[model samples]
Target: MPELPEVETIARGLAPVLRGRRVEAVWGSGLPLHLNRPVDLRALRAVAVGRTIRRVHRRGKYLLIEVEEAGAGIVVHLGMTGRLRVQPAEAPRAPHTHVVFTLDGGGELRFADARRFGWVAAGTPLAALAVLAALGPDPLSDLDAPRLRDLLAASRAPVKAFLLDQRRVAGLGNIYVAEALFRARIHPATPARRAASRAPALLDAIRAVLEGGIARRGTTLRDYVDADGNSGDNARALLVYGRQGGPCRRCGALIRRRVDGGRATFFCPKCQRR
Candidate 1:
């Protein structure tokens, strides 16, 4: 799944290519991809056709493409597994391209998802508030240590569960959460409040890990790529994620893997003290 960094990279890439371009047409071939939104395929074309692309932004994993006309924005979510690609005008459309945006400038924006889990919606203000209103603060935004501490302290779930809760903290996935907790030296099985005293450090580590991933354009694990179809560089910089059976950078401990919430979590058991 493309987490915060990957989504941000996609938004940044799309911003340059999509700005100033008029929506010549908007149409899709798949069943309703948007979560709980109306699936009328033709409605996309009716409202979005004359509008100009204004800007592209991201909140959590959702990408918002603002347009001039009201209720005609494009909202994308790369669900458990989804990808967006900017393809050449003549390139053959791949299978699973549920949605395609024909640009006035002679190119196409394609939304292809093998899992059919990705989503697309059209609305002004992008319906961002309604879509992401339940999400917690972005770890890379104004969210700070004290606020994180309060949220964690208020939860009795396992720290990993708390970390994975999108309503408690936005933009963190299994990979980043495992990496951050490992860096903070907290066991994944630790209760949320067990690390209450170390919340500041944990928060800092979370920020550092996420920022590092963003700087590297996100980690490319299972088919995650930027809009330009480039692999992320952060996979090389990861300390714990996907490093199962590998040595830890901090203490030379063997990185261990375990299933948590049905997802793989990698950690340096020796370094991540319980």
Candidate 2:
């Protein structure tokens, strides 16, 4: 899944290109797309066609495009394998391109998902959407050590699982969580409450890794890419997410991988002792 940094990067790449551009037409593949509600092609056209895009921003992992009309907006969630790009109308459409919004100036904003797990929701009052309503505070803008401490202290689940819960702290996925835990020197299996006392360190690590990811354009181990169809360069800078059996940079111990809740977590046993 494209996490916070990936979504934010896409939003940044899209803002300049989309702002002030009117949506001249809207087209869909007729194939069903996962929607926050039962929004059909007509509803999408009602909200998007002819409206100028006023802003493009990200909340958690969702990209929000606010339009000129009051209370109207478009929200997109780029699920695993999903990609959003802007190209000339004459450009060849990538395989699986599901939604296309023709802009006034010969440009088109396209959403393509090979696995069909992504969603597109359009209408008024974007906050009313279930997906956006269900998200917690964005870690980058709203989280702090004390706030994270209180959140962690209330959970009995493993710290990794707790962090992965979008309701508790939005925009984190397996990769960043593992990297954050390793940076904080907290074992993946440690109970959330037991990790509370180290929240300051953990919070710092989280911010560091997230900022680093944004700086590098996000980690692209596979399908993730910015709006320009460029792969992120952060993969090689990862500390422990996918380096199983590799030597730990902090300690000479070999890195390890363990699966819990069907997600793989990487850590250094010596550096991340419970």
Candidate 3:
């Protein structure tokens, strides 16, 4: 799944191309792909067409394009194996391109999902969107140490799970959580309450990892690409997420792997202590 950084990358890349551009036409696959709770693709056509995109924004892992015409916005969630692209209107249409937004000029914004797990929907005012409304504070925003400290002090779940919770720290997923934990030298399995003392370092680590991921265009281990159809470079720069059994980049100790909250977690056992 595309986490905060990948989603942010797509939003940043799409903003200039989409802003002020009118949606000349709307296209759908005629099949549902879980848009806002398994809605039909036809449902999107009515709301998406005839709307002008004003801005692209990211909330948690969801992408929202403000529709200035109708005071509504479109929300996109790139589930596992999903990609979004902005291409010429006459570009060769690729298979699995489930949704296409023909812009007012000469290009189209496309949403492709090989695994059919991604979803899209229209939201009125965006703030009223249920999914976006439910998300907690964006980590890239005003999520500071004091606020994060309180959140950690109240949770008993494993630190990794707590970090993954959208209600706690929006935008963190398995990949960034593992990397952040490794950077903070906090074990993934440490109880959140017990991890409070490390909250400052953990918060800094989270910011560092996310900023690094965005700067590198995100980690493209699989179906992630920006609006320009470019793969991410952050994977090569990853310190821990997928380096199980490899030497830690920081300490030269053998990296370890475990499953936390049903997701693979990597760390240097010598560095990350419970």
Candidate 4:
């Protein structure tokens, strides 16, 4: 799944190309694509065609393209193997191309998902979009030590699981959470409240890793790319997420991996003692 940084990268890359550009047409594959609800081609054309794209931005892991009229917009979630890119209107569609938004001049913004897990939703009063409305505060913008402390203190789940809960702190996924915990020296299995005393450090670590990811564009182990079809550089800079059995950069302790809630978590046992 594309996390905050990846989603933000796509939004930033698309904003200039899409802003002020009118959607001239909307096309779908006719194959089943997750619509979030039952939004069909007619519904998409009604909200999108002829409306100028006001802006492109990200909320949690959702990408939003707001239109100029009635606070209406389109929302996209890149489930696992999804990609969004802009290319010449005449360019050949990629293998799984599911939705194409033809811009007024020459290009098209395309959404392709090999796995069909991603979704698209078009609606009015953007606030009425249930998925986006239910997301918690974006960690980069709204989270701080005190706020993180309160959230953690309320959960008995493992610290890793607590942070992974989108309803508690939006945009964190398994990859970033592992790196953040390693940086904060908090064990993934530590009870959330038990880790609350280190909330300041944990919050700083979370922000540091997330900011670093955005600065590097994002971590692309696979399938993730910015709107320009470029892979992220941050994967090479990862500290712990996929370095199982490798020596820890800080203490030379062997890096380790474990599965928590079916997600791979990497850490240094010596550094991240419970």
Candidate 5:
């Protein structure tokens, strides 16, 4: 999944080109997105085709594009293998290029998802607001240990599971969760309430890893690219996400991996004590 950093990279890269541009023409393959077949594509075309984009905002893993002319917004979710790009109108279209928005200035904005996991919804302002309303807090906020404790004080789920829940803390997926937990030296299976005391270090690790990911563009294991179609470079700087059986960066102990909640959870067994 393209989490906070990856989505943020796309939003930032797209803001300059998308803002103030009017959608001159809209084209899309006749395929159902989000499995919400029978979706009124006409509504999207009618409301968005002529409207000018006023802003590009990000909410968790979603991108919100405000169309001021129509008093509406377009919401985009880059599920798994999705990529949004800005290119010349005459540029060659790649496979699975599902949606193309032709701008009045001869530029083209495209939404291409190799696996059809991504979706774009065009509607009134609520299109963006509904998405923003569903997510929790970002790690970059002033979410200190005590506050974090109040949030997870009731859950007995593993700490990693708590972090993965968007309702608990939005914009985190498997890769960053594993890395953050390892950095905080809290075992993934530790009960959430029991791990509350470590919230200060945990929050600090979350901010550091997420910020570092944004600085590096994002961590690209596969099929992730920014708006300019560039892969992330942060994979090289990862501490433990995919390093099962490898030496820990901080300790000589070998890294380990286990299946937790059907996801691969990696850690330095000796460094991340329960």
Candidate 6:
């Protein structure tokens, strides 16, 4: 799944290309991929046609495209494995490109998903979207850290699991949580409140790790790519995200891997001693 950084990167890239450009039309596969309505590519065209894109924004992992003709927005969620690509309207369409929006500027924004887990829904306002309604504040914004600290302090879940809970801290996923825990020298298996005295530093670590990811475009461990079809460089700079048996960058201890909430977690056992 595209986490905060990857989604944010995509939103930023799409903003300039989409802003001020009108949606000329839309097309998509007729079958709904999941329990949701199969995107009637026609409905997309009807709602968006001639509506100029005002801005692109992100909340949690959801992408929002604001339209100018009405007080409305389109929400997109890139599930487990999905990709967004922008190509020339003349480019040959690729398989798995389920949704294509023809832009007024003669370009097409495509949504491709082999697993078909992603979704798109239109709404009157971004806030009324179901996903946005439940999502916590964005981590990139002025986060309520003291509130987060209180929340985590009350949970007995493993630190990593607690971080993965969107209600506690928005925008953290398995990848960044592992990286942040390693950066804070805290073990993924540690209880959330075990390091209460260092809560502030731990919070800072989370922010730093994600900010670093955004700065580097994001960590593309697998299929993630920006709108222009570019892979992220952060994966190359990762300290321990996918380095299961590699030496820890800071302590030289062998990086260890384990499963938490069915996700791989990498950490330095020695350095992250609880």
Model 6 weakest lDDT span, ten residues long: 34-43
How does each model score on lDDT? 0.82, 0.90, 0.85, 0.89, 0.85, 0.81
Instruction: Identify the leading candidate in terms of lDDT.
Output: 2
Q: Write the per-residue lDDT of candidate 3 for residues 80-165, one digit (tens) a residue.
A: 87788889988898788888888888898888888788887877666887667777788888688888889899998999899988
Residue runs of model 4 more than 4 Å from their true location after superposition: 34-39
> Per-prediction TM-score, please?
0.92, 0.96, 0.95, 0.96, 0.93, 0.92
Lowest summed lDDT across 10 adjacent residues in model 3 is found at 34-43
What local lDDT score does residue 72 receive in model 3, on the 0 to 100 scale? 79
The true-structure Cα RMSD of candidate 4 reads: 1.5
What does candidate 1's lDDT look like per residue over 1-274, in tens digits?
Answer: 6988889988988899988988887667746564544455565676568778888888777898888876357778887667787777799997777888888878888888777677876664455457677889888885888898898889899999999888988888888898899889999999998777888989888998888988999889778888888889998898998889888998888999999878888889898878
The true-versus-predicted C-alpha distance at residue 20 of model 2, in Å, is: 0.2
Q: List the residue pairs that clash in candidate 5.
A: none
lDDT value, residue 26 of candidate 4:
94
Which TM-score value belongs to model 1? 0.92
Better of 2 and 5 by lDDT: 2
Model 4: lDDT to the true structure: 0.89
| Preferred candidate (TM-score higher): 5 or 6 | 5
Candidate 1 Cα misplacement greater than 4 A, ranges: 32-43, 70-72, 127-129
Cα lDDT tens digits, model 2, 179-251, are 8999999999999999999999999998988999999999999899899999998898899988999999998
